[model samples]
Target: MHRTQYLNSVNDFIDWFASNLGHASLFAHSYIDRRSNPAAPRTLAFTTLFDACKQYHWKHNGAFGSPAGACLQTNDAALSALRQALQSAINTVNDSKTLTASSAVMSWGGVRAGNVRWLTANSKGLAQTIASVCAALDSDNLSHPVLTSCQPLRFNAGMTKVYSLLVNDFIIYDSRVAAALGWIVVKYCQARKLPAVPRDLAFPWAPAKEAANARLPKNRDPGLGNYHFPRLISGELHAVWNLKAGWILAEVLARASHNPFRNSSTVPALRQLEAALFMVGYDLPLNVSPSGVNSEPESYAEGDWTECYTAARGKLFHYRVEEGGIRLLDGRFYPVAVINRMLIILVELFGTDPFPLANSATKVRVTPSIPGIGYAYFQATDERGNPPSASALAAVLHELGVLNYTPDNRAPWALDFGDYVQRGRIDLEALLKLESERHDDVGELIA
Candidate 1:
């Protein structure tokens, strides 16, 4: 959180959209490819990237947008459904004296029952917090008066969704959105060639469902100490940060009045940018080097890799088998899955074979923790299972007799899947290219 008093950083943020639209495009393209290449953000026109990212978000984001392709014609349906459902639930419940816990939970299913129970258990606190939010909505000074509950409430992760429904222009400030937004701010500071990132732009990150550096999209660059984001806990701090983000983004949109999204396209809402950030946020740097931070990822031919779950109909994602890893259609080569030994992984669509790092012999990892930076396991998944498998990486190994699993096991994991990863000639070449091309940034002393 160290920083200099760089007051112009906020204006520079707005200016990023106004003058740096092309760079924004590049950032957007590279942002989509972050799962494979986190350290480097690509360059493209902002207008083009804006559209591409929306489609990407629609395609992959677990219905944060849609389950593929923006396609213009079908883009508004899901968002409309989400907004309408929540708006209706909020507007009709007791004519809006306060957002009841019942209506809030009904609007956003992600709210934990325990949090809802807590709100229900204390009516006074919920009413007070709702009033505080309403007051902020009415105020001109977004940052002066802090937004916190009278009670020790820490359900901002869930309640924000409810509040987003009740309040206009608020977004679901989850871990992904927070991480992506922070990364964007860091990039703006870097592009402006600022001496250091000021505290005003330093947004904190919250760990997702898993512990250990889920490596859920962060700055992998070491020298940029002033820019490194701190982990955020969910409570008053989270609410304050969420409000700040909303305010900052609102300013950016308002200031950048004629920025493509406003005039010709049906895409002026704040949610479009939110959806874009959610997609790009899913990635982190695989390798970073001094050759230049924004190296271009290898280009995959149209038919290089088959789309997984094609039988799932409109569920479309195509990938390429290349030197670095299995590159998704959108240029995402994430470390999603593994054979279970290599630091627990993150295979998104297909199973890949890239588990080169060894686990600590002294440590015993709990199954399904998704522990480390690792490889992918590819398998065909025609049907999404109960609790759903990330990729049917195990099914491939099971058929080839490389590993085994049971119906009782939900994830593609086994207790004794062995420590070492074996690779054939092609796989080894790609793994070698992964090392050569990725140019990983580890072991360097921080500046």
Candidate 2:
């Protein structure tokens, strides 16, 4: 394959593998309500890992696409095999056992944000082995000192399968590895009687710094082997750029709103916009602590909680219902069932029928895919099904039937607020007034 094409394919496969791996673990853990307006934990995890991995890979080599390919192909066998391991781990983590959130470890290390030494020590060696295999795949850096480590070994499968298998393996193993590490840390804590730290359902790796990205660490000591896989136990950003654009869209649509009931295009358009947010890219929160570090937090608001929000700020997500399917901007895709999942979420958040839109009344076909970078589109169509119209959406909702619009059922998503704030009700008008008065960044943008 041409170098550029080869790199693109590799990256694409990586993206797919990352999202799948993260999602598999997350979906197994909890059924999230997207409409609650909370972020997708799995999706955030995927983007975080991808960026970190990309950054790490790029560090040894200058650029990712071409320069990195040379490094990857040299030791293709190791890389390929490792990828397969990661994929297997991802699948196994979800299907093997029942993993509860309370018992989960969100990050393998301590409470500190940059504690990747534990992760790197375990996986960095693997990257080196893979890099050795990939050294011959590219023309540019074949002469580099790193290439000297490259020992050509014959491979069995086609390049694509080999690559896919390797990616899958690494991801699966990555989970196992991290969990193992977490166990070790926990043990150490228990040995000394350290208090247990809480982890999110899906354990997340830390984000990459702007100056240097993170890379997989080499296996430091085989003694850590006991930590790899427990026979089956399983688990598992900022940006205002899109906010400005979305506000612009919302304003444009608001202008078209005619009757007090609804506008011709605005409601669906906003729904589409909401769907697109899932597709947009964002950073994720990660928890990590190095061995020998002080793991306890001296203050309440400083550590992991702070990290979580920082990651939230880095995510710029977008979703839109276009031609019937939900599209995401971050190159990951989901089925229309995912769309309904999202709509159900929003219905709960803003109250059912907050807009003129309704669920589709007929059987539907859903396929979600991202054909290019920076976005994913989901296409939903009726199978002789229902006429594809705004009303059809409502029809489907009616057929499926229950809408989650009650208080007792909505507590998992509730945030603390005074009577003035109104817990369950999302007062958009009041919010707008607050924004207008504050005249902050969001207000300025929306205004």
Candidate 3:
């Protein structure tokens, strides 16, 4: 397909989808208010696209954008209309005649402002090349070398799987999504607009002091713990102590009194926040023993740990301090979903933008510290200074448990295109190959 046709299809699809999404948002608000509870309409605000699909009626073979979509059924008329709209939008883009060419122009203008550059390799070594020479003859200011040499460039189109499977495609990565949703609600309230009953609206639960204290006890004494608790002192005495004990000590004292943990009131709020995230279809463990901690404390034990765990459905979090800039920690790397969920919620309240390319349609999600993939290992120098063998690399990752994700990497691409046989998410044939499985659906759903 031609570039112009491809762009037109994509633009049209976005227009249709965005328009339908606006209506869906309003319908969702009304559905929550009328059917569930009138007072706490915002309770269902974070319902995911998948959750919405299930709540309404959406049927297909697998994840969104998949071709086997006609199999699904829904009894609800309005929901059926919405699902059809989404499917039509996707179909219009995929069926574009302009994108038919095997090799199409890949524009980076949205991301790099025409100065975009990527490394290219050859038998000799990697030499910086422009995208213009790599493709057909194109504008110099707005293009790079044409990247047509197959073995020389070493292009792998399959890398897109990671972007779709790991990254959250929702535009909500930026605060715009939440702000837009919130704006809809605020407008409804201001205009006294009410719609039909909500299907799952209820009074959003509030945390209680007793419940919060039950999970973690308050420590008034600073000496007994690593975190110090503050005590009241007069301004003159505080000034004198600050001068004598150093600025660090005085800062610690002030932080102990004001920090979220020391405040005590935040415990219940955290607990309630945890509960709400769980409700929104995130897989977060309620309570789990921290690694290396003994099974002695009331909160620390195997029995106390909840079996709740869902992979792919992890949380995204980003934070910044005066010293450190924006950093995102997607919780899928953790063994326990609870820890992941906690970090997710904690960051949402205190976190910044989750990833770069916050507004683009094709942004890559970074999987932090993934063993063997991100880091390069060179054990011994070859006569000509060559890289290590694949077998040696695999051995190193195996020893470090980098290759072995706790849930076992039954990822999306393997089923969709790899050797795994059968159809549907977690095809029965695929399960037969596994010894035991916890969250295979995680790969498909997240993808």
The prediction achieving the highest lDDT against the true structure is 1
- For model 3, residues 1-447, the per-residue Cα lDDT tens digits are 232333343343223323333242432321221122435533334343223333321122222232323211311222223234333433343322211111111110001101111110111112112111222212211112232223232221111111111111101110111122222223333334334211111001111111122323211111111111122232222212112112211222233322221233322222222122222321111212324232322221111111111123322222111111111122112112222232232233223222110111111123332222111111111111122222222221221112221222332111112122212211222222120111111111110
User: Least accurate stretch of 10 residues (summed lDDT) in model 1?
Assistant: 438-447
| Candidate 3 lDDT (Cα, 0 to 1) | 0.21
Top TM-score hit: 1
All candidates in order of lDDT, best leading = 1, 2, 3
Return the number of clashes found in candidate 2.
Answer: 92
- Misplaced by over 4 Å in model 1 are 1-9, 22-25, 28-48, 56-114, 119-131, 142-150, 153-155, 211-226, 263-268, 286-447
Model 1's lDDT to the true fold?
A: 0.42
Query: Count of backbone clashes for each model?
Result: 22, 92, 29
Ten consecutive residues with minimal summed lDDT in candidate 3?
107-116
Which residue ranges in model 2 land beyond 4 Å of their true spot? 1-131, 134-180, 192-324, 328-447
lDDT of 2 by residue, 93-174 (tens): 4311111110011111111111111122223243343334334322322233433334433221112122223221111122
Question: Candidate 2 deviates by what RMSD?
Answer: 26.5
* Weakest 10 consecutive residues of candidate 2 by summed lDDT: 438-447
TM-score, predicted candidate 2 vs. hidden true structure: 0.18
Judged by lDDT relative to the true structure, which candidate is superior, 1 or 2?
1
TM-score of candidate 1 on Cα atoms, chains taken together = 0.48
